[model samples]
Each structure stands twice: as C-alpha cells, then as structure tokens.
Target: MNGETLQLEIKDNIACITLNCPETLNALSMRSLIDFHASLKQVIASHEVRALLITGTGRGFSSGVDLTAPRPGLNPDDPDELLRDYFAPTYQLLKDLRIPTVAAVNGVCAGAGVSLALSCDIVLAARSAYFVQAFVNLGLVPDTGASWLVTQAVGSARATGLMLLGEKLAAETAADWGLIWKCVDDDKLMQEASAIVNKLAVGPTTTYSLIKRLMRDAKNNSLRDQILLENECQSLARKTEDNAEARKAFAEKRKPVYNGR
Candidate 1:
C-alpha cells in the first residue's frame, strides 16, 4: 500500500486503485503487480469495501509489462518462466476479487493492459483511449489471461485478428465490437466510472455477489441448473430488508434507499 508504483485509497466503501508509473507509461512491473494484488486482497477482505475502481496515473493506462525489470529465477536464461510470472498476480487478483470492479481507461492500453481492463466487471474507456494486442508485434504470445479474456469478450475470431494483426482499436470501435462496456469523453471517463461505483456501493451487496458467481458459473451450468440457481438466489434476496424496502417504496411511489444488505 505504501509503494510508489501504485496508490490505493478507500472512501465511502469504494476503493480506488491507480497504477502510478507514468515515466514508464505505468508499465506493469513485478513489484507493482505484487503490491497491487496485495492491496486488492486487503480491500476485498475488509468489511468496509463495497466497490473498486482501477485506473492509471498517466497519459496511458499501461504499456504492458516493464521489460527493463530484471528476470527472476536461478536459470537466468529462461525468459519464458519470467514472463509467465510477470503479470500473473494482476490476472489472478482481477478474477478473484469479490467486489464489483470498474476500469477507467484514460489512454492507450496495449498487450496485457487490455486484458487487465477486460478483467474488470465494467470497462469505461475515454474517447482518446485505445486497446492493442502488441504481443505479436513483439514476437510473443498473449499472456496474463489475455488469450481467454479477450476471446471471451469479443469472440475467438476477433481476438485472433486483434492479437495477430496488432491493430490499435479505438475506444468507440472497441465498444462497438463488444470489447468494453462503454466509451465516454476524455474528461468524463473517471466521473462516469465514479457514478457507477457509487451506485453499486449503495446497492444490494449480497445479491450482486450472488449474481457475479451465478454468471461465472453459467459457462458450465445447464439451463435447468441455471434456472434452479436463479430461483435460489431470488428466494434468498426476497428476504433481505433492501428487497422489503423496494416493495414498500414502489407501493408508496417513492425511491428506495438500499442499505446494500
């Protein structure tokens, strides 16, 4: 949390994480990745955190891994092993984070950076922002869960094209391709992402967690099983005070104040 590579701050049940390595275009370094993962786990375990927002501190969100950093391991010759563990934590933390996460991409997101943005529950990119899979250009394959996450978001064919061609997809084009949630003005990205996080922070916490789990499991669940799972979730949700307040507010023709119960 005290590292200069990243900054983490919590307020109003929302944790904001900013990747801070502007000189290197906020490139993902090993130490930074480890610190970020630790910080995320801390926030997720804390009872006060309800939502998370991740962004960058410079012009670009990130240029992907910091190639200048020293490779780890006894075999100083094995670059493959080093690359495998480089951004491993970044990918794992995103997938394991229980709280709803949002990515506010303000600029260029290349290589593993695209995967990082895609890992978030919702990705809000600025008009000036662009996504690129520069791995092929560098004579490397996609890492940090990019291969799966990218294909999952935009399908296998598009993912293949993006990775192989190393094309830079603009924010609007990425949105059109269903690669990101939405695109806004250069200056409004953070504001819009903040509003979304505020909404989730005050909404149904338990139901949101359940819905996240259900959706992830949907990839493997049969239709009948999914229906049953939904039934169970709904049955549980209906008993919460937030649900009761919703019904009361509807009957009274007023807005409900959810406590995220």
Candidate 2:
C-alpha cells in the first residue's frame, strides 16, 4: 500500500486510515483507490486489529473520484465490468471487513465519499461537515453503493431529493434525518472518534463481528429468518473466548479483559 495518498497506522488494536491527498480534497485517483484497498486488506488480515477508523486529512474527507483522472466510462470498456473489477471490490471489502468499522467525516463528504462513510458500521461527522450526493450535478449517477446506502439510511423520498438536487446536507441536518449516527463539534471530531474506536478495540469483537453481519442482513431478512440467524449467532458467540472471559470476570467480580477473541 502506498502511504503517500493513504496514511495508515495501527495502535491499541485499532487501525486508523486517512485519505492523504488534501490538495485534491483526498479525491480517489485510480492508484489511490488501489492502494486503499491494499491497506484495508492488510488491516483485515491482521489478528491485532479489532476495529477500524477511516477519515481524511485537511478540509474534506474526499470530493469523490478525481474527475480529471482517466475513468472507466470514458473508454469503450463495459461500465459494469469496470465497476465489478475496480470499484466493487473495494466496497465489498469494506462491507465484509468483519470488524467494527467507523467513519469520521471531518469535512466535506460528497459523491462516492458519501458511500465510503455510509459503508462503515457507524458514521460520525463534524458539525461543520456536510454530505452531498453531487452526482446529478456532474451528470453522472451515484456509484460505489451510494444509491443503496443512502436509500436505506434515509427513505426513498429523501434519497430522491439528495440524488436529484445534489444539495449539501449539513452534518447536523444529516443526523436529524438519520443519515449519520451523530455530529460532534468540529474540533472534537477526532477526539470523539478516537474515544469511540478505542472502546470498540477492546470490546467483545467476535460478538461485534456477528452483530455487524446480522445488521447488514437484517433489512433483507424475514422476521423468522432473522430470529433463527440470531439464535445461531448467539450460539456461536457463547463459544468464543471473550464470552468465557466475561463469565469468569463476572464470577470473580472483576472487569473483563477482552483480547478481541
């Protein structure tokens, strides 16, 4: 993974990934996106990382794709194939990360950037931050799962408004609309994100992983199906080392030390 465009660091069982090309508002160049996927792979493969935090440097999380860069649709290549090979993999990796993932939106989050933030298990934004679909303004449709994520987060009506108008949604307004988890003071964004991720790092990670999968499947699942899935997951959770540790700690009247088993 190239560190120039994407800064990555791991500490205390949490991996912090930052989009580093601030001058371009951390826009995703083809190479940058590749490197980002590589970095995510490294984190996902590591046993030491139990949680992930993603953000960006400077005043924007990302302006989405670098418009000046050569992109797929411009060429004769099938756009669907291009998406499947290049864009889809990165998004799929994020969705299947199998760990608690958090997105800290520090500034302007737009276009595919909106999808990036929404891909996380939890999304927190700065009070000054704003989200924009921005696709219609560019005469392009939403990509990188933006359509699905936004529609699911908000309803079809709001999703249509955001996508069609491409207006800016302030962070506070986003929270009120249930588009994000919460909006913190701009200065406290990183501090709050760090606190949240640090708490997750030592949490019952196996259970968290299960919860992540279930939550994603929840929307698509029937009530009976989800209940059955929950039972199975709970059964699996009971067998995890963390569950045993918690039980032992409870019996001993001590705080449980979770190694993210």
* The candidate that achieves the highest lDDT relative to the unseen native structure: 2
lDDT of 2: 0.90
Candidate 2 lDDT by residue in tens digits, 1-261: 348589889887999999998999988777677778889989988889999999999999988878676664435556465456767899789889889999999999999899989999999999999999999998999988999999999999999999999999999999999999999999999999999999999999999999997998899999999999999999999999999999999999999998777
Please list the C-alpha lDDT of all candidates, in the order they appear: 0.86, 0.90
Q: Please list the residue runs of candidate 2 whose C-alpha ends up more than 4 Å from where it truly belongs after superposition.
A: 70-82
User: lDDT tens digits, residues 189-261, model 1?
Assistant: 9889999999999887877877887887787899999999999989988998889999999999999888778
State each candidate's clash count. 0, 0
TM-score of each: 0.92, 0.95
Cα displacement (angstroms), candidate 2, residue 127, comes to 0.4
